[model samples]
Target: MDEKRLCLAHDDSLRMLRLARRCDDLVLAPAPARVLRDADGSIDPAALVAALPNELFAPTAQNPVDLRFDDDASRSGCSLVRSCPGLLRLPDDAYLEVLTAEGDPLCVCGSTVAHVLVEAGPLAMTSAAVTLGRAVGAGRLSRDAALVRLTGFAMELCGRYARDPLAPLVGDVVHDIEPVSSVRELRAFLDEPTGLHGVELARMAASYANDGSGSTMETCWYGVFCLPPRLGGAHLTRPLQNVALDWPAEAAGLVSHERMRPDFHWPRYETACEHQGGDHTSEQALEEDSRRARDYELCHIHYLPLTKKDARDVNAVTALLAQLLSIIAPYETDAFARRARRMLNDEGVCAARRVLLAQLLPPRLRWCDGDA
Candidate 1:
């Protein structure tokens, strides 16, 4: 719509708000605001005057504030202001009294005054109503359009989250596991050890040399499928388990899994001591175990350290925060935002991050063993 038209509608809305506010305050005053009833026993002034302060009254009064009720146009059962011009100019209290009396005013002067007030009431609040009304009206945009834009925004945010400094580094890489599930799958993968010819051969490569002999099938799977869609659109379920862990979990080390076992399964050939039983499993063993193989759900899509530029920077952190903010913002809705504002300037961001981490944590991590 053109600016002029939009402004007009907004103005109408503002007026409505002001009228509502006035009606509400006037009704609750110590003295009860009463209205007159016509001969047919209808409340001539309508119940709107009482309903106003309670906020129970509709935004659109029974009759247009600018125009009095029309018999055919309104349910309020009154004639339009043009037809009752004498009643429009009455002072607020005097007109309300005549309305309560439900009869023609005893004097012509009273009628003229009542007519004027009715017109003035609506006009007084028109501008403010328009601005607020326009905002409420504009917010009803198509949800489908919103979803599409949000989805794109989500993807951009995920990239930032993937690059956060708090994320794990490569050399600290202590764990690695195969993508296979059952023994049958393990045997199949081991048997078909593609091109390389050693015990610890590379199953995937990220870059190819001048000869172009090497391929990045593994890296491709890791990047495209391993990372979760923090936004929307992509639909790869259980992406974490699908991740193919390289010898060292680097940025491209992990691939997305359709589903993963709760525990990172170790091969039977790997020594039992190495599997779960080790001499180091002594004092504070439980704490070590808790951190060893995180429950699958606790895993987040992250780049492993490999490049020399794997250092922290402010801009990078800010970008990551932006993306994390988007993902968690929906949950930190109006109610949550209110509480957060009282707590910190970045309350929404902090709340979102906390909520996201809580969601990522496995059920086991929610509590620690203690005396009950």
Candidate 2:
């Protein structure tokens, strides 16, 4: 953020520009001379490489760095390097499209890399999510994995002031947007015809994805409730995620906190659900959860809190599904409950969630044994 330092958009910045190439060329580092250009405002590979730190160019194949144009007209190619690390790549056509937006996407400062705030965060996330869908279509990544990331990224974006370190780098990249509204934005991006792969799968996930998950665990639980039976989910009505719960006169004096937000809220059914991870099991935490549940009850809302143990058990999840279905739709309760309960242990579901947690969960909370 310091304006004086040469700051290039680090890894995965949507604003970062690259010499476009085929899929094969994407992983291989570009020969310095080939990518660095003497053309107006562009880079010169050799000199820039010498001046830049090795960290700038060492990003993993998953998330590559972007090269930018030179700041000075006189020395068009020796731009200094300011880089960080993250992962995303814009397809050739999509990369060029954003530059034409109203304001200048890139703002260079100093003799080296300049700090940049690209509005293209949403664009990059959308592309990254859908582009991964391409792997799903090709049998590379499971639908569960792709869906978890897409939905997880969406939730992080929707958390307003809260940023999860485990979430994609986009949490800080974009400004004001909610979960469902962001979904609309994603669809809008997809609406424009482009060569992005996995369009169909991307569309489906966007429809099911919502905002406002408080943690990775909540996201896992939310994913369980919303995805269809065929896709290893309970197929329940998608709940409003981490929405506000207003205190009624009867519920007053129940809790000292001025604001209350549940992990999942369903207005029509008057129901709410919370995922209690290990962090919530302390005596103080349990007592607070008890008080909050009482407050929710006082407010005439059904509060359902599930811990990590319940998530690992199929029977427990099935019963929970039955309860959820009964509240949301009595007619479909038993059959849907039975069918979807098996998803808790399904390989695809477990694998998907496992990878998601590994990538996004903070080191202290990560686990690979199963979904939690």
Candidate 3:
């Protein structure tokens, strides 16, 4: 892999994740020195580490934020793990973790320095895939949180966002280059990844992953509904995410719209799920939502509407799951409902999953405890 790159050592995951939210990749003010390159033109790790800044300016819980996420404890230093000889066994929460490397390693599976940059003015920080791979290999996060991030990263790799590796997490898509990666490509990436740790875990998480998420919460909720019961979910059949559908004549007339795009849809069951965020509270959006519900009634497609409030509540989600199972009639309706309750209640498998995801997820995308 001779691609020009700027890599982050997977350390202090919280700090890295914070920076990643601001700029998915960093565009370094490239400074060229002959020491950075070997005679063969490959990157010289020792030279690169000494040349780069260990830390740069960033937010302490998303800049200019409310009192909730930001605090004094979050003001800790953001260290950039550097590479040199004897680079092995870093703190597990090390920068862009490297569990192992190939025949040509950056270090002994524990240290990583940036690759030989193209020296094209500046260098970008790190790719979402690289962050995800490192996080998984580091083995610091809970499996649920790691898998959620893996899925989100895979989605970022797909569609318009693929073009701008440095695009902000919540920014508009980049239209310059067409998307060329998907969850499948992510799997392929992990298969022969540029030496890192936790290849197997990342691969396994990718196996359960799908793309086409509109937001972090959407991705998290999808995992909630689709992951097997063992993973603290109902294990329902996976559904298509954010797909456009040609509405029937009756449906269009009912909603006064010709096109219908459901956030989550199951073709076999003819059911759909929509996640309502802050934008949905507007007067116009409320009217549209009312019309949409009417349209669903006319079309006979079972619709499930979820909001941030519904997402975080165990009783609410359990009740919602029961209703969904009743329509599908897969298992005894009451059983699945009760199962959801057991899984999501305090100290339940899903409850723990939620707590961790809330902590690990990026800025403005957390399932904060008091927010709901």
| Best TM-score among the predictions, by candidate number | 2
Clashes in candidate 3: how many? 16
**Candidate 1 lDDT, 1-372, residue by residue in tens:** 100000011223223322322231221111112111111212233332332222322334444323232233322333311221112222232111111223322123212212111212122122222333344459942322222222221221111111111221111111222110222222233244233122121111101101100111112222222222331111122122222333324422342332333211112111001112234447776565444333221343221211111112222222433333333335446764453234233444333323322222122223422200
Clashes (N, CA, C under 3 Å) per candidate: 39, 9, 16
Runs with alpha carbons beyond 4 Å of true place in candidate 2: 1-11, 14-41, 44-64, 67-121, 130-134, 143-145, 160-181, 195-198, 253-257, 313-316, 326-372
Predictions in order: lDDT: 0.24, 0.50, 0.48
Using lDDT as the measure, the top candidate is 2
Query: After aligning candidate 2 to the native by TM-score, how far in Å is the CA of 367 from where it should be?
Result: 6.4
Residue 171 C-alpha lDDT in model 1: 14
Give all TM-scores, in the order shown: 0.16, 0.61, 0.57
lDDT of 2 at 271: 86
Residue-wise C-alpha lDDT for candidate 3, range 1-372, written one tens digit per residue: 332223332332223333323342432132233322221223333433432324632323233111110123322132222232211222111122111123122222124343322211001112333455566569866556655555555444342233122334443433323233456655655555345445555566667666676655566676667766555466777788777766766556566657777878887887898988668978999999998887777787888888766655545555676667667665346775666556545356556445434532334444445422
For the record, the alpha-carbon RMSD of candidate 2 to the native fold, in angstroms, is 9.8
Clashing pairs in 2: 6-113, 7-113, 8-82, 10-84, 37-43, 41-70, 63-87, 80-112, 80-113
